[model samples]
Target: MKHVIALDVGGTGMKAALVGAEGELLYEARRETGRERGPEAVVEGILAFAAELRGYGIEHYGEPASAAGVAIPGVVDAEKGVAVFAANLGWENVPLRDLLTERLGGLPVALGHDVRTGGYAEGRLGAGRDADRFLFLALGTGIAGAIGIDGVIEPGAHGGAGEIGHVVVRPGGVPCGCGQRGCLERLASASAVTAAWSAATGDPRATAADCSRAVDAGDPRALAVWEEAVEALADGLLTAITLLDPRTLIIGGGLAEAGDTLFVPLRAAVASRITFQQLPSIVPATLKDTAGCLGAALLAWDLLDTEVRA
Candidate 1:
């Protein structure tokens, strides 16, 4: 059976799959990125991993992978197939697409920003599949967004568009790594919540999930921290709604896994803050952690379609 390679490269690990033409995952695998070994090592690891997947496809499916797609973290220049910069991975202007193509014996390859790819999958195949316009927010260690329009995620000029995390929500509040104060991620992300809860509980290992449990138990301190996060998140989302007017808003990532603990209050807060902006249906992402891998598959399929049309 013919298949394509889909890879999602994160800071610490990579998720990959062999996807069939019908969008089914034929095979899946995971590997460590070994980022601590430096940028060059990471690149070599990616190349090796892609090559291995290609070989596995050939051996098991009796056909080589026709194409490949890679979703990577950081500022990516998708048009040029370059990974612009990834602070966590220590990458700078890496020609990842070209390297992968060459390593995979010239198979066509598509590279994209990780979050944008995930949003694209959500727009085309997940929560926002039916919406003409949507915004996908991932509230993990850090917050990031993807803007989907007419079933496609817009990468924006310079590939820096969906940086909703950096939006100033607190003004003079917390200091951000981007040299800003009170950024949305500083207050609303899972990491931020974990830090606050940990500080409050005097337990260095306390996590956001712990806070959720505390809130469920009616702990006043946990409720206070959770409410603060919800308020900041609502404020940031309101700013996005005012600017984009998306039809649906999809929330995913670790914090989103809190289920009603996060969404019930979040929906109410967002609703209360809205004045004239059309209220968007706030929903959870269905694809979960697999979104990025599936999204990479979509990119690979798109590359094949583009080639056929050309």
Candidate 2:
């Protein structure tokens, strides 16, 4: 069986897995990104991770991987394999693809944006499996989105199409880390939820999980904060639905773990606003945190198939 090494690089950690052609994981490993250091150190960490995976593949499977794929955050030029800029990681115009290829002796390599890859996996095998058009919203430490249509993932010009997090859900409400006021990330992201709840209740120790627990126990403040987040998210989704008319809207990332607490109100809010447009299904991401890795491996497999066709 031909094996591929898939790497999903996040702001906090990097997840790696050995995936077969059939989308099965044979082995996996991950490490903290140590992003506070710098970009070169991050690249060195990735190389070291890949080297360790190479050793594991050689020892356990009796050979090296057929190819490798990597998914990264920020603005990624997948066709060029360059991360144009990653503000969190302190990287700009980094040639990650060529760097990895040189380190791995020129084996085939594929690079992609983290959310786009996650959307690809969802469209192909998860929540959007049957939908011709769908949107993937990731609400983790930060917020972003990905769009898929007709079984094709459109990365848009400059590879930054589906960034709905900066949609200004609340005008002049709260400042965001992205140097903007009232971006959706500042209102509805996991961190934002925690901060908003803390600020509203004057409890400095409150967290997003705490807010969810309070909502479960019928705490009015927590419920109000959570409801505001859901409404902002709904407003953003309304615009997306009007434009794309996606058949499904997949919610992924840490905040999505709230389960029904997040989905129930979200669907209701969307339904309330969406009268004339087609109402889409709001579902949790099936692959969870591993979607990026799986989709990266799938991109490598696509490259393999393309080579065969050529």
lDDT of 1: 0.95
The true-structure Cα RMSD of candidate 2 reads 1.3
TM-score list, all predictions: 0.99, 0.96
Quality of model 2 by C-alpha lDDT = 0.90
- Per-prediction count of colliding residue pairs? 0, 0
Candidate 1, 20-118: lDDT as tens digits? 998899999999999999999999999999999999999999999999999999999888999999999999999999999899999999998898899
Runs of candidate 2 with Cα error greater than 4 angstroms are none
Candidate 2 residue-wise lDDT, 1-310, digit = tens: 5689899999889999988889999999989998988889999999889878877888898888888999999989888989999988999999999998888777788999998898899899899999899999999877889899987788888788899899887889788777889898888889889898899889999889899989999999999999989999999889889988899999998889999999999999999998789999999999998899999999989988989999
lDDT of each: 0.95, 0.90
lDDT of 1 at 187: 96
**Candidate 1: misplaced stretches above 4 Å?**
none
